[model samples]
Target chain A: SQTIHQWPATLVQPVGSPLSLECTVEGTSNPNLYWYRQAAGRGLQLLFYSVGIGQISSEVPQNLSASRPQDRQFILSSKKLLLSDSGFYLCAWRAAASYEQYFGPGTRLTVT
Target chain B: AQSVAQPEDQVNVAEGNPLTVKCTYSVSGNPYLFWYVQYPNRGLQFLLKYITGDNLVKGSYGFEAEFNKSQTSFHLKKPSALVSDSALYFCAVRDIRGAGAGKSTFGDGTTLTVKP
Candidate 1:
């Protein structure tokens, strides 16, 4: 069975501080990875997706960026955090031949 | 561009009564539709999907959705509503492979409340 892991399940960052959220999939290779944000009581908004190492496609322009450094490792980063960046960040992965996606536990980011 | 719409902001249903959450989509060529559920402060859980084959797709937790090609709707249905069933439901659509990179467009989501 495949399992997705995200670190710092909850994060509190000061305004203008750097941000980093890490995700790793245990049992899949060459899977497509995605980054999503959800505002309070709102639906998910796609931020970025990566098809392979060093390949990333951004959906909406924002303060955040994503990278696929390794086949099973994806990282979401920002040089400086903004107040508007406070939300729940999710990392999901889907197999190449499958349309279904599996989401991670998620990280609750509160930028103060 | 591919998109999805969940018309209802919220749906309230009494326990033991059937419930339906409506979802519609617009996409070129064949579309791959999916339903996901999110509990409070939790990540989205996969409910069901309509990639191909049958129009009626059964998923986790006794939930099912019917795909109506003419109407362009995939409405989720349940035989009976349970208090635990109260959550946020999201509908997503993506164009078939070779069209795009398999990125899904999501709806605004509908909150379902099952009253006891």
Candidate 2:
């Protein structure tokens, strides 16, 4: 069975601070990773997706960026956080041949 | 461009009654559709998916969705509603032949409330 793990389940940061959220999937290799943000009562917005190591496709232009440093490790980072960045950040992964995505527990970010 | 639409923002249903959450999509070529459920403050859970073949797809928690090609709709249905079934449901679509083949476009989501 495959399991996805995310760190700092909840985070609170001051405005203009750096942000880093990590996601790692065990039991799967060469999976498609994605980063999404959801505001209160709003639909999810895809921020970035990576097909392979060092390959990242961004869907929205914003203050966040994603990286696939390792086959099973994906990281979402930002040099500086904005107030608008406060939301629930979710990381998901899908098998290379599968269409359904599995999501991690997600991190609740609050930029004050 | 592929897109999904969940017409209702919220759906109220009484327990023991049948429930249906409407979803419609637009995409070129064949569309891969999916349904997900989200509890409060939690990540989305994959309930079911329609990649090919059968129009009726059954998924976790006794939920099923019917794919209507002509109407371009994939509606989630349950034989009987339960209070625990209340949650946010999302419909998503992906175009296999488009530029963003693996990328899915999600609907705004519909909140389902099952009353006792």
Candidate 3:
């Protein structure tokens, strides 16, 4: 079975501070990875998606960016955090031939 | 562009009654629709998907969804509501031809409250 992991489960960052959230998938290779943010437990806003290593497509322009450094490792980063950047960040992966996506536990970010 | 609409912002249902969460979509070509459930502060859980074949599809935890092509709707349904079923529900749609690298368009989400 495949498992996805993200950390730290919760984060608190100061304004203008750097941010880094990691996501790694076990037991899958060359899967499609995605980054999304949910505000106040509402709808999911897609931020970025990567189909392969070094290939990332951003959906909406914002303070955050995503990278696929390895086949199973994806990272979401920001040079500086903003108060609006605070939300629950989710990482998901889907198989090349599959329609459904599997998600990680997610990281709750609070920028103060 | 693909879009999804969940008309109800919130739904209140008593336990043991049947439940339905409505979802309608618009997209070019065939649509790949999905239903997900999210508990408080947790990641979305994939409940079911409708790709093709049967209009009725069953999913985890006694959840099912029907795909109506003419109505352009995919409504999530359950035979019996449970108190544990209280959570947020989301409907998503993506064009079938968008298989390469397309992202799914998700609805604003509907909050389902199952009271005892």
Candidate 4:
């Protein structure tokens, strides 16, 4: 079975600080990876998606960026965090043959 | 562009009663609709999907949804509601027309509150 893992399940950071959230999927290769952010009581906003290594598509141009450094590893990063950047960040992966996406536990970011 | 609409922001249902969370969509081509459930402070979980065939699709935890092509709706339904079913439900749609076609557009999400 495939499993998605995300680190620093919860984080508290001050404004202008750097941000890094990691997501890794085991048991799958060449999967489509996505990054999404959900504000309180709002729908999910797709931030980035990657089809392959070194390929990233940004849905909404913002301070955040995503990278697929390895086939199974995806990272969401930001040089400087904004107060609006505070939200629940979720990472998801879908197999090339499947339409359904599997999500990780998610990282709750609070930028104070 | 593809989009999904969950008309109701929240739904209230009593335990043991039938429950329904409405969802409608708009897409340029054939659509792949899906339903996902999110518990408080948790990631979204895939509940069911309607790709083709069988308008009625059954999924985890005794949840089901019906796809109505004419209505452009895929409403999530459950015959018997449970208190545990209280959570946020999201509707998503994907248009099968281009590269990276599986990327989904999600609705604002409907909060299902099954009262005891």
Candidate 5:
């Protein structure tokens, strides 16, 4: 069984503050990772995805970035957070052979 | 561009009644469709998928979906609705032969409310 763990379940910060959300998959290696943001009562928006380490693909232009430093580790970072960046952030992993994606618990961010 | 459309913003059904959440997709190549459920403030859970073969696929939580090639629709259906079945449902579509995979286009999720 595979499990994805996301840290800092809830965070509140002021404008221009740094942001870091970490995600790690315990039971899988070399899995495709993705980052998505969902506004309150809205649909999901794809932010970034990585196929391998040091490789990140940005789906939409925003104040966010993603990095896969290790086989099972994925990190979402931002130099400075914006008010619009506040939302529910999710980290997901997809196996090489399967199209189904498994998502983590998600981090609730609030920018004050 | 591959895309998915969930026409209804919400669907209301009474417990013990049949329920149907509609989903339609558009893609250039072969379509890979999926249905997901999301509880309040939680991550999306995969319910069912239609990759190939049988048009009817069964999945978790007593949910099933039927794929119609001519209609270009993959609708989620259940014979009986439960009060616990209330949640947000999303429809997703992917083109198997497209430029890049690991990316699926999703529709604006439909809120399914099962009343007791």
Candidate 6:
């Protein structure tokens, strides 16, 4: 069975602080990875998605960026955090040939 | 482009009663629709999906959704509601042959509350 793992399950950082959230999938290779932020526990806003290593697509202009350094490893990063960046960050992975996405536990980041 | 609409922001249902969460979608090509459930402060869980099969799709936890092509709706239904069913529900659609091929557009979620 495939499983997704994310960390720093929870984080509290001051404004302008650096941010880095990691997501890794085990038991799958060459899967598509995605990063989404859910604010107010409502709708999810797609931030970035990667089809393969070194390939990243940004859904919207934002303070965050994503990278696929390895086939099953994806990282979401920001040079400086903003107050608006506070939310639950979810990382998901879908099979390269399929449409269903599996999600990780998510990181609750709070910017103070 | 593909888009989803969960018209209701909230739904209240009594336990043991039938429950329905409405969802509608738009896409330029054949759509692949999905339903997800989210508990408080947790990641979304894939409940079920409608690919290219029978309209009525059964999923985890006694939940099912009917795909109506003419109506462009995929409404989630449960014959009997449970208090544990209270959570946020999301509808998503992916246009297989459209511009945004790999990405699925999700609707603003609906909150379902099952009362005892």
lDDT for A58 in candidate 4 is 91
Q: Each candidate: fraction of true contacts kept?
A: 0.78, 0.72, 0.78, 0.72, 0.66, 0.72
lDDT of 2 by residue, B1-116 (tens): 88999999999999999999999999988999999999998899999999999899999999999999999999999999999999999999999886869899889999999999
Question: Candidate 3 lDDT, tens digit per residue, A16-79?
Answer: 9999999999998899999999999899998999899999998899888888989999999999
lDDT of 3 by residue, B7-109 (tens): 9999999999999999999997899999999999889999999999999999999999999999999999999999999999999998987542368989999
> Fraction of true contacts reproduced, model 3?
0.78
Task: Quote the lDDT for B24 in model 6.
Answer: 99
True-structure Cα RMSD, model 3: 1.2
Residues A1-112 of candidate 2 have per-residue lDDT tens digits of 9999998899999999999999999999999999999989558899999999999999999899888989999999999999999999999999999999999989999999
lDDT of 4 by residue, B1-109 (tens): 8989999999999999999999999998999999999998889999999999999999999999999999999999999999999999999999988643869999999
For every model shown, what is its TM-score relative to the native structure? 0.97, 0.98, 0.98, 0.98, 0.98, 0.98
Which clashing pairs does model 2 show? none
> Which ten residues in a row are the worst by lDDT in model 5 chain B?
B97-106
Residues B1-116 of candidate 1 have per-residue lDDT tens digits of 78889999999999999999999999988899999999987788999999889999999999999999999999999999999999999999998855554899889999999999
> DockQ winner among the candidates?
3
Off by over 4 Å in 4: none
TM-score of chain B of each: 0.96, 0.98, 0.96, 0.97, 0.97, 0.98
Candidate that scores best on lDDT? 6
Candidate 6 residue lDDT tens string, B7-103: 9999999999999999999998899999999999889999999999799999999999999999999999999999999999999999998578999
iRMSD for each candidate structure, in the order shown: 0.8, 0.8, 0.6, 0.7, 0.7, 0.7
**Model 5 agreement with the true structure over A56-99: per-residue lDDT tens digits:** 99999989988899988999999999999999999999998899
For model 5 the TM-score comes to 0.98
Least well predicted 10-residue stretch by lDDT in candidate 3 chain A? A58-67
Better of 5 and 6 by lDDT: 6
Candidate 6 chain A weakest lDDT stretch, 10 residues: A96-105
